[model samples]
Target: MKLSRDIMRFFIIPVVLLVGIIVTAAFTVFYTTTARTSSGKIISSNWPKEFTHDFSEYINIMNGTPTISDTGKNLLVKNDLWIQILDATGKEVCNYDKPSTVSDTYQPYELLNLYQYGVGQYSVFVSSVNAGDTAYSYLIGFPLSISKVVTYVDTDRYNSGKTLIIMIIILTILLILALTVFYNVVISKSYERIRESLGSIASRTYKPVAGHRFLREIYEGLDTLNHDIALADRQREKDTKAREEWLANITHDLKTPLAPIRGYAELLSETNTDIPFERSRKYGAIILKNTLYAEQLVNDLKLTYQLQSNMLPLKKETLNVTRFVKEVVIDILNAPDLEGRNVSFISNSEAATYFFDPLLFRRAVTNIVVNALAHNDTSTEVSISLDADSGVKLTIADNGNGMTPQELDDLFTRYFRGTSTEIKAEGSGLGMAIAKQIVEAHDGVICAESMQGVGTTITIVLP
Candidate 1:
């Protein structure tokens, strides 16, 4: 994993600052140590070097070689550095503006001590020279204070200020360039990656982004959003297809009853036919029955929609669940269509009261029981049982033609009829769906367990 840009910045900025400090220090040291070598002589603004070089000139004079000129002597005197030359016997042979504190006669050992200790208000240096059989010593002294060293450098190269300004400009440019490169590589590139990912998302062809710690989090979020969008698209397509299928099914169901009603009415309205009174009444009853079937189908559609939209008003009341289940089962068993069917209701508990909408609950229970009776052979047996384990539970089990796993999966979906050969042509295919909606509105769960050629069991749990 790559590091975050902010963390990299946190690490790089201090390193850059330290490097800048070191570079500035190195530059200062470089120019401060700069010297001009000329005439086999090194000249610098350093005071220590000036004192040492002045002492070296005296060695030539003490050796009788006399290399120092009068100009050099005056230069040393002008800087307040006194000079002395002593012969082999330790007698002072020459002196250049020597101070009153200086000894005229000095022993070699005594001068050596002074040079080593620098004992007086002045700092001193002593050197010895040999000329054939003769030997001589040179002594030099200057003020002991070291403050003059900085003053010397300031008076020389740094006095012009040009080098300092140029160094500052160069360092500023380098620092700016360093920061720009860091920003472009670490920060700007990450932003570019984000923009590219967004573009891919807009085109619905997004790929997961490889990124650093923080950017990785962002990429994960984008992936999640992309997944959700894809799911929503799929759901939209499924809903569209379902709506089309529902329209087709509803059209067919409506026309099935409407066609018969129209034929019978047309037959009765034919004045040319001398219809018997009994035939005319039969025709009237047929039209009324077909009309009622159509009206019920329409009402089922309206109720399903209202329940789905949470617009179905409920008249809730407290009632015994056991009694309610038994009554609903009895009513279903007494229906003309279920006249010869085997249906029974059983309950472990005699009475368990609960608050619920009796009308809606009756409809829900009726839908399930009717479904079991309608979609099975005449010999199929259905048993409705009630119990209260965790909550009020109702089980409707039938030894019917059963259903495939796929059919059971969509059994409660709107307009999804089972593939069982026993499926009725008169069904609107909304019964199970309406039942499911009603149960959920009561804050309950309903599920089915089924096996092909075995049976189907629907369990409803109410809380």
Candidate 2:
């Protein structure tokens, strides 16, 4: 239901309003005028009364009526009207400086025509008066001086101008209305689409919305948001399943070793006189071994969780990577468990020193080396190589019982183990996963390559 404000609405309406006001104000200020007539200037609506009053004055002056006075003559003179009296003999008896084009007499129809057509040039006020018992027709004529302003005002052009002005006003209002509708109803639809798209995103629905180029940044940003949201959702689903699997694996792994430890302890603690000291010592050793294993599993799980949660602290120092690998290999070879193992160190770089957390780094390296030694036969050769191109590169390779592609792919997953791990009850699957996490925390990448029967190689690169 939310609507985005279109900037066009802000700009267009003010401009349209300004234009309408200007046009209307111009009409009011420039073209309007007061109306006028022959007797006096007056309002437009009283123009007919003014015209009739002027005509009556002319009639009384031309007829020489008893009510006439100098005031009547002054009225005719001021208005520039003339009067002529004609007898039945067709001779002019009275003249008030009539036009030379004026006839001495006129037929009734001809006079009517002159009244109709000559009104622009003359006002012929005809009246019948008795003089010495004979009837005389008085033709009072007013010379019309056409005012250009008045003529212009009276022309169809004037009305047309008024019509044009009105049309302009109406058109301006309609245009403003049209523009409002276009920007509001038409342009606003884009904002409505954006609103709906946002709602869909909130509800976790994916739908692509097209956007105008004018608002390209908003469109692109929303698209990126949509993509990221989908990716996070997919990752969340994966993490949920992985969490469930990790729990299951941990339960099975703990129970497997605990069962042996408990059984051995029970055997050794039994009140049986038939049990020999040799058998008791062997059972005690088995219990100790299983207890150490369970302890190791718990410690590995704790380390992995700390590393995953970014709580594992690091003590960084510059160490010679080549010498470091060599020292680790020597220690592995010296170990009582890996005494006869064929483990060695090889390097292309002489002294590849880098800053890293040694304790965590050593644990990562030890886990990989221990895994190699524990999985393969004592005759299987294991090598730790160190090299530097741009930075340090360490590789742990073994010619042990190699792994399949699937096992190699899942090697770094938490609680994931290959057939080698299940067969050899040695280390928890969390070792490789923890090692990968620790290496990555130091801004390094760890990769494993393996074949079905050849060997497995774990590579760590640090920048």
Candidate 3:
């Protein structure tokens, strides 16, 4: 399994982005929900504890003098904190910005309530200072949120549970890190297999990516690409093989007729021998026929190329459908060699006008009709039918040896002739292909149906 840089980056980038987003969101929630602004600085959940005790260092009495420094007093006013200094009797001695709600003296029970809950909405903290063995108490109050919660614990119990809590938290973090590593490993392995499968596409050797629930979409797209490429490759090979065969056939066909023409002309050109007139005439006719056969083959090749390249100009006009079809069939069957053929023409109406290029259309019709007769014996009756209902429809059907399923499928493709056919004449192997193109050029549809030994039918539908 190969894991290229691109695949690794593709997988890593998204995971990295996800982790970043989670971390950023966690910090955002912590700050936005729990943080408060104090004196141009952001203070967190412990703001109350820090604010109350931070003034203690500036509150020491010196040499029987009670003192609160200027810096400590500024901190109290800025944070809206109040300070009250009390002697041993619980009577206020000195105060700074003290609240009106606070009385001049506090009793024992009031002191307990003040220490635990503070005055009104304020939460308070206490600090002690001493000078010359005189101990003075200071109370600092801060007005903030609605709740004042303090935990009172015995020293032994607190110390005993602290180690267990630390161990539990450490184990939980370790478990989380292990699961993260395991998840990444599995994801990396899956991407490696997918990378290998993608690489196989270049060599046309595909591997199925199955049982990957998370990578279902990727695998499905790969499967479709493989299938379409395989189909296209097969079609290209088939066309190439067919084209090669047709080239071989064309060479053989052109040479076959040239041999007889050259041989007969050489015989008639002999100067020493006096040839019989009638025999010479026969040789001349033989030469002419072969020459015409070669000419027809060349013409078919030229027309096929012209149609394929869309270079053939179409001259369309309205023509009487029933009359045009009847004349075409009669003209084809009027050939001397086709004298014994049995045929019939059928039509639902006398006349209908359809617009099409007659010259190209005639070639298309002649090719289809001759195709039916050439493959069948003279005794196998043929019928030509036309209808003006809905649109124009023409059908040429014959009861002959017919064709197999494979032949029917490939009828309009470039196949020289089927193995089952008895050849009286051969074409350039592009007859049906040309006919289909002509019909399609006129924006019409041509299709064929055949059953083995039952007969064959070719249908043409025009818009």
Best prediction by TM-score: 3
lDDT preference between candidates 2 and 3, better one? 3
- Please list the residue runs of candidate 2 whose C-alpha ends up more than 4 Å from where it truly belongs after superposition: 1-177, 186-188, 199-205, 209-224, 271-275, 317-320, 334-342, 349-354, 372-381, 388-391, 398-409, 419-426, 449-456
| Model 1 root mean square deviation, Cα atoms | 13.3
Residue lDDT tens for model 2, 60-80: 434443233466567657756
Error of 3 at 460 (Å): 1.8
lDDT, each prediction: 0.77, 0.73, 0.81
Per-residue lDDT of candidate 1, residues 1-463 (tens digit): 4756655665577668767976999978865764333233433446554566545554454436434567667767666667777787788887777788778897768876677666466767666656777776777775553222323455666667778889997998788777757754665567667767788888888888764675677778888988888889877887778768878888887888889899988998889999999998998898888788888879889999999898978889988888888888878878887887898888888767888999999999999998888888888899888886557889999998888987887889887766577445556778899999999999999999999898899999988
Q: Top lDDT: which candidate number?
A: 3
Q: Write the residue-wise lDDT of candidate 3 on 259-308 in tens digits.
A: 99999999988898789999999999999999999999888888888888
Model 2, backbone clash pairs (residues 3+ apart or across chains), number = 0
**RMSD after CA superposition, every candidate:** 13.3, 15.1, 7.9
- Give lDDT: candidate 2, residue 459: 95
**TM-score quality measure for candidate 1:** 0.59
Q: Which 10 residues in a row give candidate 3 its minimum summed lDDT? A: 33-42
